[model samples]
Target: MKIDWVIVGAGFAGATLAERIATHLDKKVLVVEKRDHIGGNAYDEYDESGILVHRYGPHIFHTNLKHVWDYLSRFTRWRPYYHRVLAVVDGKKVPVPFNLNSLYALFPPGQAARLEEALIDEYGFGARVPILKLRESEKKDLRFLADYIYEKIFYGYTLKQWGLKPEELDPSVTGRVPVYISRDDRYFQDKYQAIPEHGYNQLFRRMLAHPNINVLLNTDYREIENEVKFSRMVYTGPIDAFFDYVYGKLPYRSLRFEFATLDREWFQDVGTVNYPNEFDFTRITEFKHLTGQEYSGTSIMREYPYADGDPYYPIPCPENEALYKQYRLLAEKESNITFVGRLAQYRYYNMDQVVDVALKTAEEILRGI
Candidate 1:
């Protein structure tokens, strides 16, 4: 039997679109996933120790988009979670974003105040800017902050995380680290920030529960896509694989996660910590903090960065981009298929962004349906 839609990859892209299209457009969708479960890279579950752990490192739901938050809230309740990050620096645990609180906490009160004045004088008051982004700021004025941040927090950590020199990477990468004048140490300042009350798996389970949606796990698209016919297909898997890499392998960076359970009640004060100064691994996350799980024992994950793994991130290289552009042109030429999601688009988007894309994808598909 021919289905109205065939959605590949049960991650946020395929799952969100499948449910939305099936319900709103009255179309039947069959979502096939290579993985056994749903929710994609942001998938979370309670471990054997009863701590909710992210299967693929840490993922926080924080977005300025109110509509994305509202759309997700329909499926699950949220726990008000303000993600705070601590960076290990100079044999001390300092809060990241290099805020006023972190500064005062790290140095003498008088010196901290003086340095704050110097910074504000250079960047202007309430600047809310990354040091690198300040065009007219004097080099001498930035020398202290930039050198200190680069050495203590950014350099080694970035090297291990992405396997690239900080200088070689995009300036926007460094722009993410802001030197704040306020005591707000929270990592994200998004208007809406929260974690799912029952975890993301349940949210996905509810989203894809429509009768018009069929799910097939551990199914290879190449093996079965030709056998089953459909009106149209939405693929969220890697675009390179779809066309059998007719151009060349598009660049992607992947991660490796090692997790363990501890007999202790707690491990860290916060959800995430960046150990830039100490270890080969960039960060070690305690699961209970992120999941809001109340349990005696705790679970932690150690992340190791490799040259390549499962292509968690698309390397923002020029050559790969040109190749993806060629594939995109080919996809346009093909006409019957729509490619969405991080792997397909070769973008580095978090959960909310993927959801937004999926919602838009559904709307476009329904417009034609």
Candidate 2:
């Protein structure tokens, strides 16, 4: 069969590129996914208890990019959602990013008030400061507050999540959850933050609904590359795997998720509760709070980070990035093949960021075509 493009992986990168190519460029594209389903890690479905649960984990869609928001708006309607996360530190659950409100939540009012003034004085009232950067403060009170946040809030979590200390991993990893001086308890202050109205699965279906696009699920692209005729290839799988691990495998941290259904209306006060110091699992995510599903029973997932599993997080460090650069060099050598997405790029990317990269990749292809 004649195909204009053969896209590997039915995730955001492949699916978005395929949609753009098929709809805008009117090109015949075939999407090959190794998994039995579409939507990749963002895939969500109803459990036996009839509650919508993210099969991989809770993926809260939040982005500051207006173009990314407007592009995704084409396929699915959105349910306005602002994600909030509470971290268990010293037996008290406080807002993560350890904001000004989080200070009041954990400390005595007098001490908290003093620290707040010091924080605002040092870094302004609305500033978001990285815990490590805050730790560099020369002031005694500020230094104590920074150390308290690091030891209590960040250190243990980073150790468990990446199997590395706060200092070892790339600053970007720790920078993700910054200490906000503002009263904003919301995890992300992004301009657009919402989940698909139906689900991510439905969104993928709508995206790949075009006549020019076809999806082959549970099939590796290598199994049928010879069976079809395609001009160019868009690979969204692991970049190292694409070149058959020529330089060696790049390190990654993976998560093992355990889901449970409770008879109660809710499990946690918020959508997610993070255990920074207490448990083997990092956090527990309640699906009902995220999806806004009114069910008598609630479904929650416990995330356990491990060495072996489906690659979830690209381990951010100088060594890993150096290894990834080798594969990136090889990818650049190939003219007809385009590599995109988190795994392919070996970078930590949010859902909208992945979509934005896919759109750009598609645009590049269209310009050449």
Candidate 3:
């Protein structure tokens, strides 16, 4: 079909851009998604037991940007959700980020008190210190505390998630693991934190429901690229694949999810539990905690990081990033194509971040049109 713009991959990136272009600019846009559904990895649906579950994994929408939050609010109502995660460290489940409350949970009262005082004195109250930065402390007690957290929490999880040790990976990856001096156990401290009321699929449907937008599911763009007539293209798939891997395929980490339905109402104390030093899988997420759904039967998903399967996470290492830069240079030379999203950019981005970039890209494309 003839169209003004052809969007590849109908996830948040492509869907958001298509909505903006169709609604604002009143342009005819065709969105081709390889998957049967939209929303990409953020896709969620009801299972056989009638409980809503994230098909890919848990996606808690949290953003400090008011515009991004407000933009998405146009399509879906908000379900206020503050995500809490616990890690199994030393046979006890404690709050993640190795917070002060966790300090007391893992150590004796006297020892925890001393360590807390030292942390407060050094970093001040409520300060979030990166685990790597905390490890560089000159103080013996602080160093020991960092070491304890590294071994018990960060080390094994990184190994299983990325197939690399904490130190072996990029600093940006390891730096995400921090030590919170406050008792706040919430995984994110954003100003706006909530999930879409109906689920991400519903939100995507509303966003792409404009008359000027046409959606074709289970259709690979590559198969129809030569036949489809379009003025410009927005690609959200892997950047390396778009260029036929001229610089070789960019390394990506995938996930294998195992879902279980139990006869109980709830499964865990928190939304997610990390098994850093315990199991082959990184974590287990209960759908009830995430969806806030009350049902007799509950569902939980176990995420196992794998090297095969569809690309889920871009490997954040120096070598992989450098290889992506080479492909990026080729992408920049393509005047008619705009590459946006996590896979296209080869960066780890949150859902809101992806939306923000897509909106910006759409604005730029509209100006040129």
Candidate 4:
């Protein structure tokens, strides 16, 4: 095949770039996906019970970036879903981020009222304070609240998810767990938050349907790299793997999902219910809530964090970052190869952020060409 660009991985990163190059730059692009499917981690499909479920895990599309939302709007319509997550604390489901509403959910009326007033006085209303930052407060009430959240919500879940204590991991990872002073139970406050009307796979199919774009599924780029004729390469796989892990393998945390189809209309109140202090798995996600599916039977997935699976989350630690920097230095020297996406960049990025990065990378490649 005569290819102007070879895109490794048919996820958002590669698919977006291939579509842009084919439609805008008028280049023939070849997308090679190792998986038998497209859409990478965001892939979703109907199960045997006729219930739509996310294969990898629950991916809620929420981003404040207008350009990113506008770009994806070309492929699929929106479902306008506002994600709500609940953490099982003290035998009750409380809103995650440990908001004021959660305090009322878990504590008595008098205590919850006192804590809410104190929080508003200290941090002001609607302020989002990191759990670690709140823990450092000189005030006794705030410190107590922080300790409660850290112990009940953050500590156990972080330990299970990353296989490390919350304090042991990088602050960037731990600090992401915030305590919102407001009563908003929504998981994210991004301006635009929704799921694709159909599924992510459908969106990917539309994105890669351009005449100049060719998709090769279940095909490894390494197997065909020598045979294929392409001027430039866009790699969306692991950066270390691309260079054969020359600087040692970068650490990543993978997940094992156990899905079950139950003969019920709904499973949980929210889309995701986090089992922080109870279960071995990090959380359980009910797909009907996220997908807005009206199936008679519901499907839910239990995410068990493990070390031996496809790379899911790049472990955010000082040592891993330093090692990835070495790979980045090597990647910079390769003029024809461009690495974009979560695994390739070795950073934890949301779906919209990955799309934005791919768009920027595509523009850069076009200018260079």
Candidate 3 C-alpha lDDT tens digits along 1-369: 688999999999999999998988888999999999998999999999988899998999999999899999999998999999999987899999789999999999999999999999999999989888899999989999999998999989998999888877788788776899999999998999999999999999999999999999999898898888998889999999999999899988999999999998788999999999887999999988888888988999999998888999998888998899999999999998999999999989889899999989988876877
List, residue by residue over 175-253, the lDDT tens digit for candidate 4.
7768899989999999999999988889999999999999999998989978999998899999999989898999899
Candidate 4: clashing residue pairs, number: 0
- Misplaced by over 4 Å in model 4 are none
Kindly list the per-residue Cα lDDT of model 2 for residues 69-106, writing each as its tens digit.
99989989999999999999888899987999998998
RMSD of each: 1.8, 0.9, 0.9, 1.0
Question: In terms of TM-score, how similar is model 1 to the real structure?
Answer: 0.95
TM-score list, all predictions? 0.95, 0.99, 0.98, 0.98
Residue pairs with clashing backbones, model 2? none
**In model 3, which regions exceed 4 Å deviation?**
none
Clashes (candidate 1): 0
lDDT of 4 at 19: 94
